[model samples]
Target: MDSKNRAKWACFGEIFEAVAQQGIDELDAVEALLAALRNGLRAYGYRRQFTFNESGKVERLPRDIYPQPVPVAIWRDSGTPKGDLTSIWQDDPEEPEVWISIDWVSGAVESLDWELTNFEHLRTDFSAIRIPRKEADHLLSDLAGRPKKRAGRPLGPSSPWEKEQVAAALRMIDGGDTRPATAIATGLTDTALIGKALESQQRRLTWGIKTALTGNAKNSANNKRD
Candidate 1:
């Protein structure tokens, strides 16, 4: 090869190497964060908790279910340091971790993860309460129960982005924030679904979806109970 062509190929190899290294770095970072989250959960006596169906319905987690109360949090959002936290990354792998901004709370019997974010603390602040064992037992009873569902309607794994959009629509509805003028203002194409979501109180589209988005992140111990 000519000297000029040889040099061009060398530079191309270097650029390609850099890109590959960056992808490796991103994957390593994601894996490390997931490991740390699971480690903390183990330390706090928390288990896999629950798994969501394809449609996002909640189901028991079987053996990995927490034997006792354990403070936990999940990925909420990205781009802010508030209870409304956000993560900004585009490295989506085949089985990407949801990468929740979870923190180990200090003390409290049980509080809705969403409610905990509303404390006077900054969006970046972490707060947890210590709960007495006896009190925690009573408080944690019925913390997770099977959602009301129709027979023979099953959901399976779905694309994460698709789940997020569908869940977002449901959340907007559950909050009773259905305003028809919203479609007129935003010009979203799926106005019909949005309209039904606002007018209908469908649990399958509501709780089912949220469960699927934030379902059990750990699969090291796979145990499903029907």
Candidate 2:
């Protein structure tokens, strides 16, 4: 190869190596930061309360720490129940660690993994909460109870998005929006459902009993005169 071409190839290889190293460094930094946060949250005892196991019947944790009040199960199969919290690397081969978020207020009972955001105080912020393997498995099993329904039309009669639109329309009706049925049938969520309904109601389309009576009286008087 020409010297110019050889030099270009060497530069490309060096660039690739640097990019790879940067990616690795980023992952390592994430891991280290989360590890420190999780340890601090646990040490503070904010989320160290005993909780009831819903899946396996009601049972308290054996080594419960918080004594004043036992930890209550935040959710059942209905809503998104609390799951194992952890800071796991995306490239990690092992399963995610089960952890809990300790609320600073009670120091007992765990919170959801998502409550921690960058908006909170860094030193006082929740880092991570690790749950035991058994608890993690139980939470996972509970989450898997209901099968996720498909979003788009999957050989079914109606799609989930369609259902959501209809539901939104009904909500508009309940809110006293006089949106026309035709507009609602169009299946626009924010626009047709809410906006159209609001516009329809602004014109006072629904005839009030008093207004109807007054109109009839005026017509009757005109007919008598004629």
lDDT of 2 by residue, 62-127 (tens): 543431221222211112212232221212236422333332112223332222453321121221
lDDT of 2 at 146: 38
Where in model 2 is the C-alpha error above 4 Å? 1-157, 187-226
State the C-alpha lDDT per candidate.
0.34, 0.34
Predicted structure with the largest TM-score when compared to the true one:
1
Please write out the lDDT profile of model 1 over residues 177-206, one tens digit for every residue. Answer: 565423422332234555644333233334
**TM, every model:** 0.17, 0.15
Weakest lDDT window of 10 consecutive positions for candidate 2: 74-83
The TM-score between candidate 2 and the true structure equals 0.15
Candidate 2, residue 100: CA error in Å?
81
Weakest lDDT window of 10 consecutive positions for candidate 1: 105-114
